[model samples]
Target: MSDLVYEILQLAGILAFAISGALVGVRRRLDLLGVVVVGAFTGVGGGIVRDMLLGVHPPVSFVHWPNLAVAIGGSLVVFFVHPGITRIRHFEVVFDAFGLGLFSANGAATALEAGQTPLTAILVGTITAIGGGVIRDVLVNTVPGVLTRELYAVSALFGAGIAVGIEGLGGDAWLASIVGGAAAIVLRLTSVARGWHLPKPRFTDERAATQE
Candidate 1:
């Protein structure tokens, strides 16, 4: 994960998250401008938050033309040519998974570059991965998937931790990002495919008891 590679991954993540937001916008029947706005926020909102937390006055995404361009391009592509409405949810999840992994690792790399501690880097990574999605969902008036979706935040946390661990073990940020992002993506997709998730408390059925 050289600088070039990390940049590429960041672009990919931007595109993926933009696509996620665009899909949701389309499903929600928003207009073109609305869809684009949603997509842009989804692509860069997390990075903006991360920068703010790190005390970077001017967020990188705000000044980066390429980031805005990629986000808009992804939105246009999805708006113009995408799956049927019924398939939007599936595609949204796919793209969101990709974004989640790359952004998580990217966040860790950025934090490390800023000389943050391992714990802070990892936490920032997880926040960067999920913050955009959370915003996207809120804008669309839906529950954030990270709260209820199968193994969402856990995957991000694991990915960030892996990246930090790699860096701590004498690996460069690039290698850590690549490995950690891949780990997150694999775990997320696998959890979706296999219905793996954290355990939830089950309550006995009050209706059954009343009936008995």
Candidate 2:
């Protein structure tokens, strides 16, 4: 992927993540600083972790001013300017889904660019997608959505796989990213509406049966 396009995707993900986190903070009734802090962390947390796992020294997010600037700027915008942002139903899930799509697709592309195998690309992409949301939920003292939300992480996994597959087949990176992101978003929202869940374990199923 061209650096320009990659940068754009990262920025979009950061903004979405920041908005989501800020919304969560508002829901929790946190102070302005707290909201900004949570938003900043959510915006950059995934990318920082992804860089470390990929063995990128110093983590690009740490040294790059734009990453921090954009993150903080996004947080500020969400916290101060958009009090009604969370009025949208499932606001957190919606913005987080957007972040997940962009970040996951870009993560896979970055992994491929770093000369990693397809499997590594997929894993990195999935992690990049969910890592920030995990941090956000933790900070808010809530269960991470990926653990309980069906098709959440699955969306990232499928999207990442698709992105890698497209790149492997010599497709344009932008097209691959768009398709991958759209797939993840659609699957995630559909799962939400349909209440589709991954199958429970046999023991859980047996316990439920006994209860019944």
Candidate 3:
């Protein structure tokens, strides 16, 4: 993808995630500062983690001031319009899905650009998609959504894998990004609507009691 397109996707992902995080903070009754802080974390946390793992010093989010500016803008908007925003059903899910798709594609593409292996790229992409939300949930003392939500990280993995596969096949980077992101969004939304979940192992009473 062109640098312009990549930057646009990054900004959009930051804004979407920031809005979701700010909403969560508001729901948890955090003050304005706390809401903004949560929003910033959700916007840039994943990217920071990915960059650090890739050995990119200072992280792009820090060097690119617009990323932080857009995140704070999203938080302020949520802060002022939370009443109307909260009235929208599944708002968080919708925004979170968008962020997941964009960030997953971008993250995988970035890792590949940095000469990482396909498997490592996929893992980093999944982490980039979910890391921020994990931090947000922990801040509020809630279980991270990826751990309990329907096919969350799975969706990221699928998306990242698609991006890697497309590039490996010599496809256009933009096409790979678009297809991968769309796949992630569709999978996540479908899972949510259908209440699909990964199967959990059921422990026998005897085993459970023995383990306990």
List, residue by residue over 37-151, the lDDT tens digit for candidate 3.
Answer: 9988998888888999899998989898999999999999998998876454388889889889988988898788789999999999899999888988888789999999999
Ranking by TM-score: 3, 1, 2
TM-scores for all candidates: the values are 0.92, 0.90, 0.93
Full candidate order by lDDT, most accurate first: 1, 3, 2
Of candidate 3, the 10-residue stretch with the lowest lDDT total is 203-212
Q: Where does model 3 exceed 4 Å of error?
A: 86-89, 203-212
lDDT of each structure?
0.89, 0.86, 0.88
The Cα error of candidate 1 at residue 181, in Å, is: 0.3
- Cα lDDT of candidate 2 equals 0.86
Q: Write the per-residue lDDT of candidate 1 for residues 40-99, one digit (tens) a residue.
A: 899988888889989998988888899889999999888888654566788888999999
TM-score of 1: 0.92
Q: What is the number of backbone collisions in each predicted candidate, taken in the order shown?
A: 0, 0, 0
User: What is residue 169's positional error in candidate 3, in angstroms?
Assistant: 1.2
Report the poorest 10 consecutive residues by lDDT, candidate 1: 203-212
Give the per-residue lDDT of model 2 (tens digit) for 83-192: 55646448777888899998888888788888999999999989999999999999999999889886889999988989999999998777777778778878888888
Answer with 1 or 2, whichever has the higher lDDT: 1
> Between the candidate structures 1 and 2, which one is better when assessed by TM-score?
1
